[model samples]
Target: MQKIRAVVFDAYGTLFDVYSVTARAEQLFPGKGEALALLWRERQIDYTRIRSMAAPDGAYYKPFWALTVDALRYAAERLQLLLDPALEAQLLKEYACLSAFPENLGALKRLRAAGLPLGILSNGNPQMLDISVKSAGMHGLFDHVLSVDAVRMYKTAPEAYALGPKAFGVPAGEILFVSSNGWDACGATWYGYTTFWINRAGHPAERLDVSPSGTGHDMNDLLEFVRTQGAAV
Candidate 1:
């Protein structure tokens, strides 16, 4: 196991349970929420890439919410689902209050008490991350939340990967970059940190040129990885 000092985590899929929001969407939207949600998150990521690449002169300010709307619109079309004013409003409102995973808060609390520096390196804007953290009641749990918005790029971009260590003022190798997204993990690992892949979906790693240092089924296993590094846990 690598001796990780400051653990830098990827938000969304890593620690935040996005599915909780989608499932609720199903309940609230009465049959269109889940499909809308699947489309929403996918476009959320896709738009980041679009904005980053079309960096048409320091103008990549496609906020996460905008991307959500844009993606939801497109995803609805692709999935052949209808989106009305009421559905759109509900999705956005619910997203603002998405909760943390069942074990996320406890795991983070335990990790912090165990003496690890916890932080969120997310693709979300600072405001968005703040909302989710507070909704999950994890406002003060993280030492800091580093968003790619600060760098004007998404996590897959080189500039995005540099945000965490830059904010933490630590070496890349000292951070444990955890993510459920393969490409995100590849980006973090490629940047030199030890990565822990929260493979909660049982999916394979991205068919890329690199692999993360470790893969676990859930957050508990991630903590175990941290314990092996040094903490008694």
Candidate 2:
């Protein structure tokens, strides 16, 4: 136990449900909506990782917002669906307000009540985070919502993970980074944070050689893990 002083979360797929946009997407594209949404999300993350690796110096870095839009366009073209201006605007608006996970509020409240400082360190750009957090009614739960846009990089990149310790003003060892993405959990663990992997989809660990300090299926499991950690400390 590293005497955790702060809880830093990954916003997109951890606290918020990225698939929530599928409902609106379904309405617009009929039968292919769900496929589009899934592909778009996958492509969005792939773009971030590819760009981050290709532009380690940040000279060719693209904001998450731009990558998101590009991913959407690519998804549409792949599906052979017409992405007119109006439809694109509607889809983008839906993305701006992704629903928070049902467990997020209660888990965050429990962590806050336990005297831990909570923050969000996300790949989302500032406006995207602001809109999503506000829409999810989670704006007050976090003391800081850090965006990688400031560093011109994405997660799995050390510079992006550095935002957590910088925002909390604490050592990486004193912060617990929680994320639904296994790769991100491993990255945070490598960065020296006590990482918790929220394996909500029951996926296996990433092959990155690093492992999370804890693993759970959901936020309730995270709550219990934190409790046990605090007790041990």
lDDT, model 2, position 64:
87
Residue 187 Cα positional deviation in candidate 2, in Å, after optimal superposition: 0.9
- Once fitted onto the true fold, the runs of candidate 1 whose alpha carbons sit more than 4 angstroms away are 28-33, 56-58
- Which 10-residue window in model 1 sums to the lowest lDDT? 56-65
Give the whole-model CA lDDT for all candidates, comma-separated.
Answer: 0.81, 0.90
Per-candidate clashes come to 0, 0
For every candidate, C-alpha RMSD to the true structure in Å: 1.9, 1.7
lDDT of 1 by residue, 80-102 (tens): 76668897677676777777778
Question: All candidates' TM-scores?
Answer: 0.91, 0.95
In terms of TM-score, the best-performing candidate is 2
Tell me the spans in candidate 2 whose CA falls farther than 4 Å from its real position: 231-233
Candidate 1's error at 36, in angstroms? 2.8
Give candidate 2's error at residue 183 in angstroms. Answer: 0.8
Residue 19: error of model 2 in Å? 2.2
